[model samples]
Target: MKKILLLFILISSVSFGQKKLDKLLNKFNKNNVPYISVDSLASTKAILLDAREEKEFKVSHLEDAILVGFDHFEIAQTIAKLPTDKNAKIVVYCSLGIRSEIVADKLIKEGYTNVFNLYGGIFEWKNKDHQVIDTLGSNTEKVHTFNKDWSKWLKKGKKIY
Candidate 1:
């Protein structure tokens, strides 16, 4: 009985401690940061970034989103291609919400004033029935489901090929 109780407490603490990402997401949502749907952002002056790898992004991505993987060693070099306005609204997203938050934090640290993490990442955006365009400007009309491939190794977004 003691062992069972200890295991439960351990699990709870780990989950509770890991809520950092969730907290950041909640704060962003509560603050009412401007969220640009892929379509809306495509129409607006805002910058949409896919914090995923080049190969994965090549598979499919919002037409206007710049591909910049968070784990890449030289992220700042990649960031240089973006708009120079530090206050310009930038939306960062990946397969799931984890890496996006990290990237958003880094952007803020790098002097970006208005950085936002897409709460649900691309999955949530697609799940909301939003359209994800392909590289060639054709409406692919399908979610970039990360599915089990991501679930296995990435342990984040789902895989949908």
Candidate 2:
């Protein structure tokens, strides 16, 4: 009985935290780009774009994720690396999905038909036990939280500045 109660509490806490994050994201995102959950993205073959800075990306990122960067995003350079097919599925992610929306919107403006912003970005991905890789291409538990204020959202993984 105690074990079941503990499990219930743990699950409830995680769900509540997720709700808080969802509310926060809703307030920041313009909803111009649709969101893809971590689970959904894990099974998809879409091109993953990390919209965080290069420093943040070095700590850890989704496997095969291309860095387009948020602060220094260059549309021309980004486009050059994408598939010629305008309909190719693409997903963009940032620390907590805010910056990704901006990048994803740029992609949409450039006429990419199937671009999506990762629902909760890399933070949520690690929280969900999804794999992230370092610059060496080795699996890593560390995730760049962007900063201290945003670190609360990441429930799993080693937090890196």
Candidate 3:
């Protein structure tokens, strides 16, 4: 009975936390671009794009994720990196998905039909135990949280500023 109670409590807390995150994302994102969950992304072969700054990306990123940068994002440069097929699946992510929405929108404007914003971004990816790689392509738990304020979202992994 004690074990069941503990399990229920743990499940409840996790669910509550996810609800809070959903509320936060809803507040910031325009919802113009569709969001793909971390689990959903894991089973797919999309082109992963990191929308964070170069410094943040160096700390850790999803495997095969290309850094496109958010602050100085250039459509021309980004397009050059993308495949000629506009329908190709592309997923953009940042610390917590806010910045990625902006980047995803840009891709849509540029005629990419299959662009998706990572629902909870890198923070969620690491929170879900997905592997992240450092600059050397070695798996690491360290993730750039963007700032101390945003670091709270990361439930697992070594938080890097």
Backbone steric clashes in candidate 1, count: 5
Which runs of model 3 end up more than 4 angstroms from their true locations? none
Residue by residue across 42-70, what tens digits does model 2's lDDT show? 88799999999999999999999999999
Off by over 4 Å in 1: 1-45, 142-144, 147-161
Candidate 2 versus truth, CA RMSD in Å, comes to 1.3
Which residue pairs of candidate 1 clash? 145-160, 146-158, 146-159, 147-158, 147-159
Off by over 4 Å in 2: 1-4
Q: In model 2, what are the clashing residue pairs, if there are any?
A: none
Cα deviation at 81, candidate 2, in Å, is 0.5
Q: Over the stretch 78-152, how does candidate 1's per-residue lDDT look in tens digits?
A: 568767888888888886565666777777778888887665577655544565666676655444555545342
Clashes found in each candidate (C-alpha, N, C closer than 3 A)? 5, 0, 0
| lDDT for position 150 in model 2 | 94
- Candidate of highest TM-score: 3
Native-to-model Cα distance after best TM-score fit, residue 156 in candidate 2, in Å: 1.1
